[model samples]
Target: MTTFASSLKKEIARVARKELKDELGALRKASASYRTEIAALKRQVRELQVALRQTSRRADKALHTVAPDAPAESPKRGRRAVFSAERFKAQRERLGLTQKDMAAYLGTSTLSVWKWETGQVTPRARFLPAILGLRTTGKREVLQQLARGAGGATD
Candidate 1:
């Protein structure tokens, strides 16, 4: 009777271990599948990020022109330069031009120039090209441009 009881206990233990192993094997397979899916998703995300960066660079290049005359090709859709009221005022002061002079240079009214300097209004998109055009001009070049606009002959 004692021998039969020991044999029964050992058989029960063996069966329990076999069942646990089967359960563990199934879990391991599912875990591997989940890991593979996660790795694939990570790879896809990396690829998408690279593609987005390339697209952004292309758009940025399109917005910025390389040549001086490139803005003339598309004045309405030319490179957009950043503008601020303080910067505008400072640039005008640095060029030693009065508000009226700046207005004349920008082909706008004196009131508009005042409004721009005072931050009463933002400059229109149509004026961005002209504003960017003058960013590189010196006081002498501005004077020359103003003179030319006043019907003075250019040398």
Candidate 2:
């Protein structure tokens, strides 16, 4: 009787282990499938990011011009330079010009120049190029440009 009881216990244990292994086999295959799907999603995201970068470069290229009079300029940046009230004031000082002078050169009112310098308002997008254009020029060139707008010869 004792030997029969020991054999029955071993048989029950063996059956439970086989049942557990069979159940886990299906779950193991599912986990591997999920991992492969995640890897594919990650690869697609990387490809999309590369495409976005290339599109942005093409747009920037479009903004830059190649005029015969202008010559080939630095790579065209799609966005305009940031407006700094201090920078505007500094540019005027660098060229020994006043608010009225800056306004005349930019084809705006003196009050507008004062407001820009005080940070009460920003320059218009149309005026940004003219203001920034002053950065690359010297005192003589700036005077010439301003005088030309005034319809007179520069002093």
* TM-score leader: 2
lDDT of 1 by residue, 20-53 (tens): 9999999999999999999999999999999999
lDDT by residue (tens digit), candidate 2, 1-155? 99999999999999998999988999999999999999999999999999999999766544432222443232255644566676678788999988888778777889999988876677777787676777687999888877777611222
In candidate 2, what residue range of length 10 has the lowest lDDT sum? 66-75
lDDT for position 52 in model 2: 99
lDDT of 1 at 121: 70
Error of 2 at 124 (Å): 0.8
Full-model lDDT for every candidate: 0.74, 0.74
For model 2 the local lDDT of residue 50 reads: 100
